[model samples]
Target: MDTSDYNNACFAGISSLFATLLAEESQSEDCLYLNVTTPTYRGSWEKLPVMVWIHGGAWVTGSGGGLYDPKHLVNQGDVVVVTINYRLGVFGFGWHQALNNTEGGTLKGNYAIRDMVQSLEWVRDNITEFGGDRDNVTIFGESAGGWSVCNLLAIPNAAGLFDKAIIQSGGCPAMTEAEAQNVMDGVVTDLQCTGTDAEIRSCLQGASVEDLQLAATGDAPAGVNLNMASVVDGQLLPDHPLEVIESGQHNAAEVILGTNDEEIPAPIFIGVNSSAAYDDILASVFPSPVDRESLRQHYDLWQYGSYSNATAHLQTDLYFRCQSRRLAGALTASQAQDVYLYEFNLPVSTVPTTHGLDLLYLFANPTPLLPLSYDLHRDMLERWTSFARNGRPSGQWWEPTWHPYQTGNHARYRLGNILGMEYPHDDTGCDILDSLPNYRYMGEPNDWFMTRVTPLIGLLDWVLDTIFPSE
Candidate 1:
């Protein structure tokens, strides 16, 4: 029952960042606890399907508690829901040659991901005691959590811990050794450790959690601020997630994956006020002039009304939507598992269908400020729990039977005002994004955010405040 906060990195602003900040004062480094809820009405001898939730915060912030209520999924869906917490930021994802496996320490990175594997181990061993079917476990998460689920699939130790996965806005990518070392170099310089590897390891070990957190914060030596992501440590994670899946070594047999229609909010495009500004930003990200023109042609300014809006669409596709489709295709192509894809297009509020909005309905926690349809909540819960109960999300009760996302039709379910099937999803934009030589599924041009968006911080401050006014 020790649910004290895990010492996570400090973050600010609205959305999950606000919640992460509010818990900063009380967050404990000893926060690896999980909560399980099972239907009480179920027969005592019957074991319900289990669903494990991993919260998302770009791999830096977020926990598996609070706002993630599972009562509806437990009671109505007749399933067992478990939400677990893990270490984040530097304490969880820091990497240094001094702590490498070759140097006699564990992988020393991917600590957060390993923490998840451990939690799943606990579930596999003891979930049956809580009226959960250990063999029928499902791991589901959004954003970073979704990313974590994909990582778990690649880990040899995590194989067979879960049978199904639901990845919402999760992409398959991992930091290479060099990329991870870049982050570690920043930590070493920030900690002022000047010596041999052993001494540096000692110095890092002696540093306070607070100091490490500060060292990993923005403008730290890494130049890749908040670069807290899983690393391919050659042990726990042998290769990039997509590569592992493509090689037919992944563990997931059935999966449900998709992303929000608009993964990037307007506030993120603060500096792209004019078409010229947008073009400048594009020119910097895309190497070739022809590719930039093709990008512009694909996302026409006239169609989007404003440059900022156009930027939102382009980034959303590049980062979330189209990337998810690629992962879905990989899952199907590898072993041809039953993969169900979705797009949360419901405009539940004044804002566009931005990231993490589906959680409100998925968790059945509606807010008066942005009231969502109860029917939509029911639909989401049923679809998820049904998928957990069986490999398919389409139950006998469901109308217009949801089909698996095959490579041919690109069929996917649309969870919006009208919940039904959508066929042959158009992804002409992804073709353009794939053509970008600089872009890889794994984060490349590693200093991308620092080079492109860091300069826009001053301009985005007012926009963020306007959109999410402080209380």
Candidate 2:
């Protein structure tokens, strides 16, 4: 959270952002729950579409009960919205055999993901009582939650659980076993509990939350990075999502996905005051001197007013914009159905447009994030719920017709007033990003492979999980 907006002016320096920003999610590991927001319970006459929401806090922190409540979405859309609490950090994703100490069952690190799959199954079986159409389920989430939905789309167990999908501002990163094993090893070293597997398990089971937090966070470089992401375990996540999509192994779930205009900025740009500071950004994402100059001449970030504004373009494209466009192509490749894409550039009260801003308008919770006119709010509801209810977003005559994303058209509905057809965002810049080998984003785009590269990758991952069950 070294980014300036996160540490300082999150939500445009709102009183709520400054006053009550830091908070804890779970007090204990026993908590696995979900909240359902439904319109007045209707018997069987009208079955409403169900929208399952997964909150995102980098897979380390976050709860369904956050600033974005479901009352607004449920009331406005007349659909059932279920917000779930999946396991986070070590409790849900810890990949150590020592902890499983069970007599008959194996405990995998993806219990959090399993919790989500179970929740979807629950909704499918029981949501009808809550006035929901179990068959027309739409799974949507922002950030990590969005990333989770992307993984779920590829996972075999998650197949058929939902008919429609909405991924906002995130996509799955290709993961390997060695990478995950390295993280687990760091965690165990941090714990400093030396003994047999059983002994370590006993110690960890009895360890205090404060002590476990250290192991959960992992060590430098890899340790300091987001450690608790979903591992590509052969059983739970067989392959990288793009590989699954490109191979056409993925179910034909209609997708509506996109990223915000300005997503979270890179830490390198934080507190950057002058051209001297931006050189650091060029150093990291652009390694070669020639490539660095190309980027510098392309964007001309030195002209930006501050660190956040200057570094915004590269960071936004690196982490979100390009990643999303790459995923959209993978999702729709060689498929007959058109995938819907959108870009949330609507200028609002909260720092124009940034990551998670689109949610402020759609969420039920009241805060100082953004204020949308009721008319605009209604329009968004129509678009989202219409997609959930049917398969497309509907709009009034005033708004331009939002066409499905076609291979050639690259059609996108700019989610704003005076809507118009827009081309894909920064494909050339993304092509530059995809070209770099060391600066690989999402492990070199799985869609490029001819054979089953994901399974080959997953095989090594599975071996690590099996051999180092304790890790």
Candidate 3:
């Protein structure tokens, strides 16, 4: 991470690519540029399928350039790959509505979200110059990146920017206005800035980025906070993407979505953790005692062998797998075309096939740099770019012919260790979890203003989760 190390590597004839990547990227307010790689075709004007990537860090720390390399995919499929950087943490999701007063409706402070819309607009205007077919653009991302793709599909302004979308391990959930207000209040309090709106804004602008970063993280884990996410601002994003899809108002693009076998560890579910000092963790996720009990009765921790291990399996289903299956149902029921679902169950002896493991395969950017000919490396690139070129993912010799998900009959694909085409039922737990009374609005400020109360937990969750996270 030291610039001097990068300079030394460059001078030693180690690698210009490595040294340049480390040197070029700076975590600044202006880190919103796209990196493009065109297929190595003979003709410079050869039109190719364009795949735009949105990096993920739960809306906190991520950049387009460093983590993923698009060259292999681009060259193999004769496609164009674009990785983008956008605002994160405080700068991205800081919701300052009255920064300059004057009834500030226009200043919705969703600078990070706005950056995406602008980036897509930029692609629409300029991608053709890079030998990419702008008309056939496909937007794909993982985790929070996947979350952004789903929301963008529902956005009115983002209607014609792309024709396809691939969401991996992320379900779109936007914060309601009132919930957003509470989060903003918490941060402003943390900064100890009490004054008129204009004065507070000035103080905030003068504060160091370190101060802002610290202020941004208080109750939530690093890179994950309800506050630092897209909001239902009434102007840009009218409702949650799930609701919009149901009403037949979302983008009608062909969709591909799925989650990892274990999207995250149990600690994230803090509500029912099996780790050290887990008592305090529960309070953060499950605010109500009744809800906690209901959740307690539902699981038998002994079955999974250990608390941490049990919680990991439980959370994988609840947070990730369930939402993915539900999205498949939601999109398909709404008459979406070629909607495919998948579960990555591959074995990683070196590492568990958890959340963002898909990135390790799809992008040939492993730290030690795995050989380009590695089966996983080549197989994934072929599948992703093939999907970008056509709505359906091309099946490899060993893989099954991937099928589109339908309402009742749930058929899909599975990758990695138990890799093959199969009807995945790993998310059957959603049947009960989705219907829970306490688990509404995806919990907390996503719809906290209207449904935070325990009495109407089930109905409110059903309504807001099915509609928009009510304000």
TM-score of each: 0.89, 0.81, 0.81
| Candidates in descending lDDT order | 1, 3, 2
Q: Native-vs-model 1 lDDT?
A: 0.76
Among all windows of ten consecutive residues in candidate 1, which has the lowest summed lDDT? Answer: 6-15
- List the pairs of residues colliding in candidate 1: 5-28, 7-28
lDDT for model 3, please: 0.67
Give candidate 3 misplaced runs (Cα > 4 Å): 1-24, 42-45, 100-104, 219-226, 266-284, 287-298, 348-351, 365-373, 425-427, 437-440, 443-471
TM-score of 2: 0.81
Estimate, for each residue in 1-471, the C-alpha lDDT of model 1 and write its tens digit: 344433332332113334344454346666777888777688456788999999887676667767677888898889999998877777777777877644557556777888899999999999989888999999999987898888888899998899999999877658888988887788789789878888888898898765666577644222224476788878888888888998888896799999988888766776688777877777656767888899898787677877777887887887777778778888888876798999897645465888888888888555566658877787788889999988788644746688888777778898888788888546678778777755656553233332245235644545655775533
Taken over the whole model, the C-alpha lDDT of each candidate is 0.76, 0.67, 0.67
lDDT of 3 by residue, 1-471 (tens): 332211111010111222233433544554567778876663356578899999776676667766677777777777888888777766777776545253644767666778888989999999988888989999999987988898898899898999999999888667777767677777788888778887788788887665666566543321124456777877888887778887788888899899887776544443334443233333445577665455555444656655555555656766677777777777887864779888875455455677887777787543444322255566667778888988878857666677788666678777675455776454345765666645523423333221122223334345534553211
Model 1 residue runs over 4 Å out of place are: 1-25, 101-103, 220-224, 347-350, 395-398, 444-456, 460-471
Report the lDDT tens digits of candidate 2 across residue range 1-471.
221111111111011111133333324454566777776544346888899988876666667765556777777678888888777666666776565446664555677789899999999889988778889999999988998898888889988899888889887764565666566666677777669888777777777665566555432121223555677777788877767777888766888888887775433245545666566545644557877766666456545546446466766776777677777777778566668888886645345567887886678444445455555566777788889988888777786777888656567778754355698544666677666654443642222111111223345435644653433
Best TM-score goes to which candidate? 1
Please list the Cα RMSD from the true structure of every candidate, rounded to 1 decimal place: 4.2, 10.1, 9.5
